[model samples]
Target: MQGTLKDAREVAVKKLSRGLSQGAKVFMNKAMLLSCVQHKNVVNLHGYCTASICQKGGQRMLWTP
Candidate 1:
């Protein structure tokens, strides 16, 4: 998904797949690695969120935007 931040910066949001056995681990690893990266050629890891929403069949989402 694409969105505009409060500061008017455009960002692309990526939501990791839910319900996979290794989803949490993969999310953490990817977030960590991206956080450490600092290259102009690479898209920045602005932020991430992990949430469990009971309404959506207890959907667990990991979003990086």
Candidate 2:
């Protein structure tokens, strides 16, 4: 999904798969790692949402610009 942030920057939102057996700690670790990485070719991890409840169900999402 694509949307604009509060700061008006366009970003693509990726909803992490819920089928994985991994726990929240694993996902958070990965997010932290991605957020620290810096490279022109890599899509930076702008932010993430964990254990958020939506109308559909609980979901985890990653935001990238």
Candidate 3:
């Protein structure tokens, strides 16, 4: 899912698979990879979200733009 602020900034939402291991390593990896990435065409990571949604399934997701 995506949403925009009154200022017209674009936002993205990612939904991770359910039953993913509960640990910090996964998040660390994602952050590390994003930091090392350097290219003109590479996607930019905005942030990540981990919480139970009203919809069924999943607790982790990565959002990028």
Q: How many pairs of residues collide in each model? A: 0, 0, 0
Per residue, candidate 2 scores C-alpha lDDT tens digits across 3-62 of 788899999988766666535777788889999999999999998878455312556778
Which runs of model 3 end up more than 4 angstroms from their true locations?
5-8, 20-24, 51-57
Please give the range of 10 consecutive residues that has the lowest summed lDDT in model 2: 51-60
Query: What's the C-alpha lDDT at position 3 in model 2?
Result: 77
Better of 1 and 3 by TM-score: 1
Candidate 2 to native Cα RMSD, angstroms: 2.2
- Per-residue lDDT of 43 in model 1: 78
Which pairs, if any, clash in model 1?
A: none
Tens-digit lDDT track of model 1 for 1-65: 78677888777876555667537677778778888988888877887666554214433332334
Estimate candidate 3's alpha-carbon lDDT, on a 0 to 1 scale: 0.61
State model 2's lDDT. Answer: 0.79
Q: What tens-digit string does per-residue lDDT give for candidate 3 at 1-65? A: 78654467777765555545535468658756875787889777766655456223645656566
In TM-score terms, which candidate is top? 2
Better of 2 and 3 by lDDT: 2
Candidate closer to the true structure by TM-score (higher is better), 2 or 3: 2
What are the runs in model 1 whose C-alpha is more than 4 Å off? 6-8, 19-22, 53-65
